[model samples]
Target: MFKHAHFKAHTALFLQATGLTGGPGAAPLFSGLDLQIPTGLTAVTGDEGTGKTSLLRLLSGDLSAHSGTRPATDALWLNLALPEHDEATPEQVWSALQQQCPRWSTELQQDVTEALSLQVHLGKKLFMLSTGSRRKVGLVALLASGATLTCLDQPYVSLDQGSIQVVRGFLNDMADHPTRAWLVADYEADPDLDWSSCITLG
Candidate 1:
């Protein structure tokens, strides 16, 4: 649930000497690398095809690293691509997650739903929402899950300014409120968030 960074800073996450292989027994994406991601907003940036998404997957515990160790973080993972199909509304998303994850409380679910302003979207269909709305839904689910760690890949992709603001605002709120550790990977991170720590890939 917790680990330490190289500087002795308390970290909830650790990716140590980790390696990743692409495709069926292909070359490694990352090898023999060690890293510690804090429990806040952290950004990762790289050029197209730089395995940024792959890295996010590793953090979410969805993909296993070929070698090395990642911090043992009790985290909730949300993959923006190929979203799951739920016949329920966005409001229902939180409730559903709560039901699915017994660790979540009623108060926590309500807090996330209300904070994300997802109250009105309860009756709407997941497919009916705009591109931005879909991404917002993903964000709401991640923030409210109380998983202690959040790893999002390309959340702002294919969204309008309003949707982007919605996402950015949520991230900003996380920073101010300072809850769990969050890692966001985007084409270009916002300067306002002090996310320059993002590892740059060739």
Candidate 2:
């Protein structure tokens, strides 16, 4: 398991949302949705039209909910596929994240980079890499961020079989962590993972 000495103290409740709705004008995705997120591996599963990504954004404080108590936490949600990062290389992104994330782990970053076979792509720009490779870059940063709460949207999507296993292994190792939570939003929870909580939307 990845080791970080300073663990941020938290209540049993890592995150709480009450009566949460998507947006102002949009139809309510789930009305009066109450959730208590604890520290551990959490799987948010739902159909295509469901608000998985929106819920993650709300948790990460990237977007405001229509109406609810969705308090923000020290969260990390990296969407590196944006146009602004197209010209940036993985090495550049890693350097930037290291400066931004106070608890960043260089050891974890190096280990994950090797496990995912991403060393070769670090020098290439984001646009020059394939979809899976780009996602791996984001995964590397996310895993090493050591944020209080880490939100991963469709983490396994577009990943190669080997890389997928690497990601899964890391999450499995984090399943019983004392602090820090990882919220993975996907279509369905992987049966192999020991999820502490599972939220189903749709």
For lDDT, the strongest prediction is 2
* Model 1: per-residue Cα lDDT over 109-198, one tens digit each: 566556556677768977777666666777777766767667888877776676566667767766633446677777666776734135
lDDT of 2 by residue, 1-202 (tens): 1111222243255777777766424676556667788878888888886778877887777766777787767898889889999999998999998897999999999999999999998889999999899999999999999898999999999998998899999998988787778889998889988777878777
TM-score of each: 0.73, 0.88
Per-residue lDDT for 103 in model 2? Answer: 94
Cα lDDT listed for each candidate: 0.62, 0.83
* True-structure RMSD, every candidate: 5.0, 6.2
Clash count for each candidate, listed in order shown: 5, 0
Best by TM-score: 2
